[model samples]
Target chain A: MTDIIIAADAWDEDIEGSLLTWIYPDGAEVKAGDVIAEITVEKLQVDITAPGDGVLSHAINEGDLVSKGGKIGALA
Target chain B: MTLTADQPATTAPARKVVMNRAIREALDWELANDPAVFLMGEDLGKFGGVYGTATGFFDKYGEDRVRDTPISEAGFMAAAAGAAMSGMKPIVELMFIDFMGVCLDPIYNFIAKHAVHTGGKQDMPVLIMAGIGGGYCDASQHSQTLFATFAHLPGLKVVAPTTAYDARGTLHAAMRDPGPVLYLMHKELLGLGLWGTMPEASSNVSDAYFEVPLGKAFVRREGTDITLVGLASMTHVASRVAKTLEGEGYSAEVIDLCSVVPLDRKTVIDSVRKTKRLVVIDEDYRTCGVAGEVIASVVEEIGTELIAPPQRVAFLDTPIPFARPLEKFARPDEDKLLKAAMRTLKHA
Candidate 1:
């Protein structure tokens, strides 16, 4: 399975910010480049988008902390 | 421009007192005094302020003035901007300053940029209030002091009152000021220690809402040896260090940038020029912070006046941790501030 793993900001040593909220849920089909989730790193917030089109699964839930290069979710 | 309470074409009067209570009291008085003044935010009303700040205010002023909103900082903050444009003074409180990440767009895009966005003349009278820093075990989510986020913005007037006296006074000024005001109340400053406990707070505050005036800096302690520029709560710590520095025969000037947006650049630059040395203290980390801006401004305007490179005594570049020791390690204390000051003295 090809995994679309979302990475964190370049400056984040660890994935410290949470996935604020997900615009899409697990098993949801999404188009490429669709904003799937909101991420907060060092008080800087950015959106995590779908890298590819397929069944989407969220690796982190709302308020759940993740690390840099950490998989926020996957499009398989 | 004085707006009246509950009556049209009437004017509210002004009075003086400690700073902390000024904003809420002004909000209360303004809401009571002005029919246009209303408050809406997360846990604002019955929670009597998210910090029990507006305690017993709703009872006296009614729910309209003391509104309790859903846990939607972005929604309410934006709504506040809209309300102000619609002719209401809405005091919007973000649950915590760290939560700015959730709702900054409305503040930055809609409120702050509105005047320019509207090509000037349209004013937003929204006063966004919330406390930065942790009361105790608030940990990362609640503990961050992110005034630098607001300070970095051009249109937002960021006010951090170190004492109750300034808190109340500056708040009064913010409410009356003709733009968006970020009125941050520190969790520690909530109980009114500067002028004694709440209820017995500075009797100097008046029922008549007055203006504290924006873009003004307060020189808490005056000295000729060195100049220290501190923004918000860090100003308090800077004041403490200044006292110790005085004991060491070094006189320092503690300048509080009451309104960060309209930074009292004259007060700061003039002080730096006189002392020939400068140290900046900010709660945010060293990089891209208020200190960075202050240092740049001083160097750009009067680089020749420096005794040495201006020093920044700032929080270590790290997230505020849960442990006391770790938190202390991250934050700038008296020792670090004094050390930075002493190092700057070498330049002179």
Candidate 2:
């Protein structure tokens, strides 16, 4: 199994982190480059895409604050 | 930036359009007619604006005039200000009004105060169009409609149009007028196709070129019992409240103060004197806001004639909350305005 960690990309004003929403639920199939979730920041909305095709499992529930560099999900 | 090309208007006829489309159509007119006019903002070219106001603008104007800048507000805002001074009329789109803080220097000291500071010799024909207001669970940072903040500053004309007709005319006036104009459009009225159904702002827009003079108030609905003042989306809220109040045997005069800086004090004062009551609804913070200013102006002008203390329905002086219920509680909605109107009319 490979971990799908939230990218550690630098963000401006990520003060309150982000509320997470999964586009594809756990145990669902996703292809590489598919938009799998969304993270809404204070002023912007960004999509989290699948790094590779696999069966997915979420490390955090919907509406959870996925802090920068935190593990969001895994692919097996 | 293209230096030499004439873009001419090809379409003609009065038509019904949503507020967002009306704004785009206005921009299309300016871009088509004026060779010097160009639009600049982050993601405005390909993304067609966050509110979809510039959806089909990029292909028509191309990259030269329909330019996109990096996410740095201070850098691009300064550039736009400089462009304005150099004879190009630049229409800058600050995606969210909340982001104005990142570029205050250019907005306050330069873009706004330039023409006057230069003894009226230099022309700064720059217009900033920004998306404002809440009710979308966009959190504190993204939700505020800061009309008071800009209107308080010197040398800038601030305007907010509630309907598609007003939107078109106001944009035309802003573009044609010299100096700086802060044109704010409520996000809920933008027709972005993301949120649920939105209330329709009047689409009785003229197809031919026309301008709604700034510093003028539009008496949206006439009444004689109590005067209700509002701006932007709040105007629509007041309109609904007026209808309900009419049903309850209260005549509520709804006034849309289109521009805050050159406030139409005469109209408001005139209405208040006739009605003997006032209710100001503002989307901004209550303390030191547009509502307060209007109330102060009316009281200072005709305090003796007022039968009741002016009531204000405004956002509490605190950061807007992210939660849906909290946002609703904090914002001045239809119910709140109705209560305010009733309070004003019933006052001893």
Candidate 3:
């Protein structure tokens, strides 16, 4: 089965220095624009959205120090 | 943009609504007053406004005057600054104050650094009317009262107008002023109005239109016992708690420190000296909040005049909640204010 991997496009100050929250849980059905995770850095925080509808996969857990070009979670 | 050809300098008396609505009125007035005055934001035109601030604005001036933008507050805010430098009075909005993180690059890197770095030869005439939403279970994403964040920054005139009157007047001033002013218009009080149909700030708005002069403090009430400070929506909250204290025979002087960055230190210091006690009723979280700065200023500037240590009636350093009771408890409501005032008296 093919999976969709949502990676960090860029860093958001809102979520700059904190953990990223998965908007949808692992193994959950998701839709476009449906958020899966949140990250906070310093004084910013934002929820990353699901790219496409699929079964969920989490490559990064909550409170993980995420950087650009890192795979956060996957959708299959 | 389009030379803003719509109404005459004095035309189209719109509906007077809430403080925020009066702000809209002020923007409309400014656009008519100066071809240089324009507004840009995400969903500002076709969507009527993210918060209805630009309702009927698009139909009035069309695209040229009311410019609609993509969801890029950082890029657009800088663009507003650039527009201001090129002689345009552009009013931009960040859907919520929490979104400021997305736009601080423009705020600090340029707006704050430009004038001085340019040897005081540049003019950044941008008014950012950020909708600072909180206290209404907008949840953590939207409910942070970030006055302290912007207030801590220099080269930014941060004004949190609590009343509709102050909102319209201050917004007018910020729009016309020759600098980057961050107008933290509260999202909570956008629904309040003076009368059924009229906004509280409708009357006594700019005759020129008059801009609310900067660096002045408003004494919400005149009392002698304890001096309490409030800013933005907290001014309303303090007035209510002051009344509760008044019934208990404690005369509390409620002063609204309307302008935060260039604070009215003399007014606050003078009040503390008289009352021999001070409690800052702030909307920000404790620990390095506006309260600490004001209190420290009073102590350092006038150390001799004191009856008690200062108290900060502010939210704990935590995100606001969605649960009703948790939200209420997280904020320093009337009960906490009342108790803090009495605690100061004990030290007195």
Docking class of 1: incorrect
lDDT order, best first, reads 2, 3, 1
Tens digit of per-residue lDDT, candidate 3, span B152-184: 868988888877668776776676567778888
Of candidate 1 chain B, the 10-residue stretch with the lowest lDDT total is: B193-202
Candidate 2 docking quality: incorrect, acceptable, medium or high: incorrect
TM-score (chain B) for candidate 1 is 0.88
Report the number of clashing residue pairs per model. 19, 1, 28
Off by over 4 Å in 1: A1-76, B1-20, B135-137, B192-208
Top candidate by DockQ? 2
Per-residue lDDT, model 3, residue B244, is 90
lDDT of 1 by residue, B1-348 (tens): 455432211331222233334455566666666677777777778867655456567788788777888778888888888888888878877868888888878989999998898888788888888777653655687777776777876888888776655676677678777788988776654543221122222233444545566788888789898998877666777888888988888899999887777777888988888888889888776778878888898899999867688888877777778897787777877788888898887653
Model 2 alpha-carbon miss at residue B222, Å: 0.6
Ranking by TM-score: 2, 3, 1
Model 2 over residues B1-348: C-alpha lDDT tens digits? 322222223332223455776787789988998989999999899887876677778898899999889999999899989998889999999999999999999999999889888999998899998988889899989999998899787888998888877888889888878889999988776544343214456365655667788899989999999999999889888999999999999888999998887899999999999998999999999999999999999999899999999999999988999999999999999999999889888888
Candidate 3 residue runs with Cα over 4 Å from true position: A1-76, B1-17, B192-208
Q: Report the interface RMSD that candidate 3 achieves against the true structure, in angstroms.
A: 17.5
Ranking by DockQ: 2, 3, 1
